[model samples]
Target: HAAFRAGLVVCPLSPLYKQNELSYALKKANVKALLLPGCESKQSSINDFHGVFQKSELDEIKKNLKHLILIDGNNSIPNFQGFEVHFFDKLLENDGNLSEEAKNSVTSDDPAALFFTSGTTGKPKGALISHYHMSNNMKFALAKGLSLNGPVSVPLPLFHAFAGIGASVYPIKHYRPIVLNNFWFNIKSTVESIVKYNCVEFWGVPTMVFNLCEYIEATNTKIDSLQKILMGGSPVYESLIKKVKRLIPSIKELSIAYGSTEFGSFVTQTGINDSEEIALKTVGQVADHVSLKIVDPITKKIVKIGEQGEIWVKGYCRMLGYYEDEEKTREVIDQSGWYNMGDLGVLDENGYLKIIGRTKEMIIRGGINLFPKEIEDVINTHPNVAEAYVCGVPSEKLGEEVCAW
Candidate 1:
């Protein structure tokens, strides 16, 4: 909190490519400087642009951009064009040099963060989130609290909303956060981070958990500090839940939370603090102040509770409609302020939501999610696999399965 106030928003990334994108994205959002890694990948780009002096870079910026600050992670600094590059180790040392402007420049509604959404549509959507969104996201997530009482650990990326807001902002709200600049998209690294951080709450895809189950059994290493694990972005398995319960009694609860970038987080399974049924039964009832209704996708008719229908939600947290696309925004957000989630679910008699399926090309097979679009996307990377259309074929046992043809 104070560091942000002090004008040094730390980007502790070592991977040059990802952190470079973060630096550029921040600049695109009007951030004056960058703390880029000094490693081969990032440093080479900086030195290549000797003519591209930091001031010249700012002068050339079409947006209201200003300066460039690079923090060299690998301890090599050439002082290119008197650019603002600091050795990575300097952050750990205190020079008593806080700037005045860094504290004064930001406002509540100013664009503070930018991220790319793996949109179901062909193009990935560049999400421009403001200070308000970041603040509110932290407020929403901190409500979930840490699984372990002493501290919380997150393995998600700082660039992603889950890790950026959930892991970073929320912790800043109350504690000294330990942020790892590394990306945790794979199983092995993700487990290592969790165990190393002694993370109480590890948030990621179910496939991550599926893989962790394999890692745990293979290593026979107990993740003791990982007391409580929460699964989102995809579904968790009963078999997986059984594994968590068997392994970590301190897990207290393996809360299954349902949320999205569009709607901010609206629902969460009750923590160990709540009834045991909160964890076992279903994704806990649509969160407070959140209005949820199931509608027939074709007719748009509101279905009765316990009946399956498309889930539509209207709440304070919904995005201010998509940034500049009114027509696209209208497609989901209706005049009534309800947002069609493209999700199919049922409201139990008791009101807990049971997500059944998605309405769009998005596929959540059994518990494994496969957006044919995303997969076709990866397959298209292969020059031979020209065009692809992945669809879900009905599976009697597993709810639904993926079939790409």
Candidate 2:
């Protein structure tokens, strides 16, 4: 309702949580023309239009949106929505028709999507990302690196860059269907999805894999078909790798990935077909397309290998910077265009990065300088434990104390 009054249309690229919330919020705000991205489920109840954008109050409220598009990054959107579904061929490239001008100018560097810096502590920085970055990341992660031949699981929302490129665009580029049905996955469902689709890969947070490990052990189901699983969003526990090796013996590889919405997966754990050590001990080798450096934050000097320092990345895969905030972009991107990732690590003797800890995740506990991952790693090594999340908490005597949860 508000967007309508303000002459703005919101094309939401989100899951059910955002869809219903935005629907109610937009009505309260007098906004409209929301292109929601899911099928109605028990959680997100049905509107009469069969899970696609229904032409009703939801559609009537907005006045400015030229088009209402449904983007189920997971491909779970039902086919019965009254409106015609517009995919890459229909929208991005013009189905079966291309002008010579369009052909010549259509480069990967063309406008792809828009995102903003979290800007939690400062003004929001919106960045216009290019197809070149998104597509290349998607192509390599999916078809080449992950060896995905069929549908992939995408629980992450498309508003985030990883799902947008890795799950949605990359699979679509190859004319593959995303396994959109059966949205949420627990241990049972995850195993079922792998068996049902003969799914070779799954991409999600490490915690998710940890949960799945718990699930399968409890259920005692066979999940030998799944090939590689990418644990990217957060740090992976070494114990989880040991669990995967024990339970899913057919898994050809286990990749501990470290990436973010800004840059694609820059480091990969190859040669780690069975060794969980590579994942826990190092962050893997840099991608062919990425160049990395460890610099001393205080002296601004590039440190030697095997030395801990602030990590900087330079590559085509890197983002241009915060969209509209020059000052913030200047803070992260160096004068030479290399991005200071705000992370601290060392490239060890074998060229694998051991993340000492984030420059921020470290805490001065009684002046001892503590890192949670170390304690957590020890706890995770326990034969009975599954995973752990470590952080610092307030302490009157020590200034702060490491809390392992």
Candidate 3:
């Protein structure tokens, strides 16, 4: 909120990131100031940076980084050599005012935030998200019927796009209260917080939601206040959906969404009134003001309806290219403004999308194409199977063989 008010591009970094990852992101984005925890645990980020970077690398980072703003007031400030160190509270003591020139200088098209992709397949790329993208995406979410009944519980980390923009920014934009879990997700703490705060909506990834439901079923915990749950960040299997509905009968809506950091927020989401089968199988219809088309990965042509192909998105939700990486950006986004989603999926005639698997993760065995997600979905249906993952392994006879675990 402070960054937005000040018209600064805020880049929220994950606390779990190590020094090398941190250095790369900081340097990549040319970050001028950094605000992080001062000291709460023995292995604080401040203390952990002691010997992680070489002197040359540290010197290069310090050139652009001007300030190290520590959040904790009680703890003594750590010496960040060659950089100006300041306490967060001390900066807040000044009069909160923005100059008219500063206010007018920031335009809606200007970058407002830099979110790094998860880098599952390669090194992380900093996504430049503009103010218009963030505001427009949230407005679409509200129009699509995201519940604002009461306080929303967010157990997922705020660094990721699913939790950061979807769970946090959406509520803040609508003037709704949010109950955010500061620490890592714990089933007991999540349930206690929801019940204690009377939170009507909850947001998390599929794994977190599954564990919460598992714990609730095991302990017979009842959270009557939780009426809606929005799960994403990964594929939500049918078994998990059934388990959630069976364990938490009070839940009125269980929505599954699909999106990425580049899109700023979810481009597709199931509605509260959607049928059980739609909620369990598809990721609902595409959001308003957005264009969705599935294309053949090789042909670069739109596939017939209900055929499987790579997903492509184009709209206000798309990011303003990657931060200073035009080569990589050009590879995904085309001249027509369509951004290749990299994931393979099938769009039914109803416009509902079913994700097949990542394009890079596809396996071709002796002229046969196999999708890991398709195989894993079947394996996950077994009663004894908690989770399943499928990958390709080198084969002597065949080009590649499917391997499941």
Model 1: per-residue Cα lDDT over 1-405, one tens digit each? 554455333332223234344444444445455544454435454242322332344433435433443544456554554345555466567775666776688776655444555557743344545566557665654365453444555555565566655665666665645535343355666667677666666666566666676788887867877656667776454556777666665665566777776666445445456454555446666655568889987899999878877889876556655544577778888999898887877788877777765667656677875556456546655756535667888889888888887
- Which should have the higher lDDT, number 1 or number 2? 2
RMSD of 1: 8.1
TM-score of 2: 0.74
Maximum-TM-score candidate: 3
What TM-score against the true fold does each predicted structure earn? Answer: 0.68, 0.74, 0.95
- Candidate 2 local lDDT, 109-129, one digit each (tens): 654555444445554345556
lDDT of each: 0.60, 0.61, 0.82
Show how many residue pairs clash in every candidate, following the order shown. Answer: 2, 13, 0
The whole-model C-alpha lDDT of candidate 2 against the native structure comes to 0.61
Tell me how far the alpha carbon of residue 188 in candidate 1 is from the true structure, in angstroms, after superposition: 5.9
Q: Write the per-residue lDDT of candidate 3 for residues 279-357, one digit (tens) a residue.
A: 7678889989999999988898999998999999999989999999999999999999999888999999888998899
**Which structure is stronger by TM-score: 1 or 3?**
3
Candidate 3 ranges with C-alpha deviation above 4 Å: 39-56
Worst ten in a row by lDDT for model 2: 1-10
**Candidate 1 Cα misplacement greater than 4 A, ranges:** 1-35, 39-67, 74-110, 140-148, 176-198, 273-281, 299-301, 362-405
Model 2 C-alpha RMSD vs. true structure (Å) is 7.2
